[model samples]
Target: MARITYIEHNGTEHVVDVRPGLTVMEGARDNNIPGIDADCGGACACSTCHVYVDPAWVDRLPKKQAVEEDMLDFAYQPDPKRSRLTCQIKVTDAIDGLVVHIPEKQI
Candidate 1:
């Protein structure tokens, strides 16, 4: 399992172990983390699971595809360099220590 950290806009932090092959959005949902709403589940069809990836781990994550990039355009206060959709990020041992900060709200 990969250990992932989800930080809320209010500074709350939830760290959980996520099984490989699942997306980051699943991790948050399973752990009952409040920030990511995942309105479209893991279909990459919405930006409700948007987050700001920790700068330190940005380069370590897999590159975003066109679909994910397009969805992020609808996220709240998206940061061009750090915004990402959790549904698009697959969990793996390589990203075991990944940290993502949830935006203040989802739109």
Candidate 2:
């Protein structure tokens, strides 16, 4: 399991352990972390689960796929270099200390 940190736009932080094989979106949903609406339920069909990866982890995480990249365009105030769809990021030991910042709102 990976211990992921979800930081809200207001600075509130939620740290949770996410099992391997689950997406980061699932981790937040399971732990009741606010800000990740997951409107598409991990299907990568919406940008409600958008987040900005912590700079330190930007290169550590897997590269974003084309679909995720396309969907990010609809996210609220997306940052080209940091924005990602939580639904597209799977949990793993390599990402044990991953940190993601939730945006002020979803689009």
Give the best candidate by TM-score.
2
Which residues of candidate 1, in runs, are more than 4 Å off? none
Q: How many backbone clashes does candidate 1 have?
A: 0
- lDDT comparing candidate 1 with the true structure: 0.94
Question: lDDT by residue for model 2 over 1-107, one digit each (tens)?
Answer: 89999999999999999999999999999999999999889999999999999999999999999999999989999999999999999999999999999999998
TM-score result, candidate 2: 0.98
Minimal lDDT window, size 10, model 2? 33-42
Error of 2 at 17 (Å): 0.5
**CA RMSD, predictions in order:** 0.6, 0.5
**For each candidate, how many residue pairs have backbone atoms clashing (under 3 Å)?**
0, 0
lDDT of 1 by residue, 11-93 (tens): 99999999999999999999999979999988989899999999999999989999999998889998999999999999999
Candidate 1 similarity to native, TM-score: 0.98
Worst 10 residues of 1 by lDDT: 35-44
The reply for model 2, stretches above 4 Å from the true place, is: none
